[model samples]
Target: MDGQEGKATRKGPGAPRRNWRLYGVTAVGLAVVCGVAAAVGQVVRAGEASAVEAPKYAVGSGGGTKLDLPVRPTVPVTLTVYEDPRSPQSRAFAQRYAATFSHLLASGQLQINYRLVTQSDKQYGGSGAKEAAAAAACAEDQGRFAQFMDQVWQHQPAPANDALKDRNLLTGLAKKAGKINHDAFTLCVDRGQRNGWVAQSQSEFAAAGLGEAPVVQINGRPLPVPPAQLTPAELTSLVSDEAQRVATAATP
Candidate 1:
């Protein structure tokens, strides 16, 4: 009789132990389902965020100049200037003022647009330089003008008396920017199809009496004085003051 009671106790415990294994399997399955659901939700959220941010970087979305100036004003004024990528003065100005200008643009205080001009001609052996400007214009067609300008200014070669025209080098730079249609750009630049536009910009500059490099115009008027070498702080102050002046002038 004691042996039968012991056997009965062992069988009752074994039944509940088997039930616990089934419960453990169900718990693990539910955990896997929840984890997969959470991962999918995160992916959807990321996609939505990307969608919202893409339009901010879209080129030519805002109208102002051919360069597509930002619509909102952080400062009360806009500065339009002509810049030659190969000019030493232009290069220095870009390096010095880039940071301040970028900050002001970020704050919506100022807008800047650049018109490119070529100083190199056949007599000066500027065929290569001319090609670069045309290639830059072609890149403009593809909405890569700002990037190409940045690269050209950063890597300009020194002016030598008789260097071979580097059409190849300029084309290589454009290709690196994903503008691989060199033939098209070369043709466009060679035929001077865009000369009318270039002439118009030149006319605007001349009418404004801007002869020298680094000419700055504030609210369609030339700066009362041009700085010999503009520092970042000076540029910041200049832009800030001009912005306030323009805002005041606009009021009745």
Candidate 2:
């Protein structure tokens, strides 16, 4: 279409075009099935896995040096998300039910873990996904991992693989988070300092033999839901019910 058409097309000549807002709104329902899929061809090519010595350390996954909320329930229920920043399913899930996770985190009822997977680089043919993972880890070091991640998902780049690979935009997001020191965050990202840690985190996820991104696990077991069909209320109810269940079980 011509510029006078008053439209911004993500596609070029001869490519099928669609409305960006409608596409984004409709794409909000994408979901990834939770399971250890047997597809094992993908690998993290960014950096070598270094040792993680923190008693509780991870990027967004609970515990360690990662991005974990301060939820200290005794005998806590765990929610680990093996996710990728560029995964459409993860974006969709965030678009719809991120508030539910936020509510759960506030209640301190579950130990949430975000295990990042950069295999989308292999699946999508670029290093953007992998670099995004590292950038997120840098945010973790700056104490904005949780806030920064919510913002990332909330305002993810369109066409996940390509636009999100920009290093400047990724670091700029940290600056936008406000809590993170922009200088440190910038240096961390620019120097690719956390790439090794990000690689190690992804390595752990791969070694666990998990499937694709947006893999949800509760108590170290897969928790599958039809992301397209799930409602926020239902998810919050599920969290409440799980909290009660854990409390009851721990009483004995």
Q: Which candidate leads in TM-score?
A: 2
lDDT of 2 by residue, 1-252 (tens): 587454444345324344666666666634222122222212232222354444353335544465554545664878877778877788787667676887887877766888888877778787777788888888988778877777678667664447667877887677677788888888888899988887897788788877777777777766657555668787667667777887888785
Clashes of each: 5, 11
Backbone clashes in model 1, listed as residue pairs: 73-108, 74-108, 74-109, 75-108, 75-109
Please write out the lDDT profile of model 1 over residues 185-243, one tens digit for every residue. 66766676766776565566557666756676766777666745556687678888887
How much lDDT does each candidate structure score?
0.68, 0.72
Candidate 1, poorest ten consecutive residues by summed lDDT: 61-70
Question: Any idea what lDDT model 1 has?
Answer: 0.68
Compared with the true structure, the alpha-carbon lDDT of candidate 2 equals: 0.72
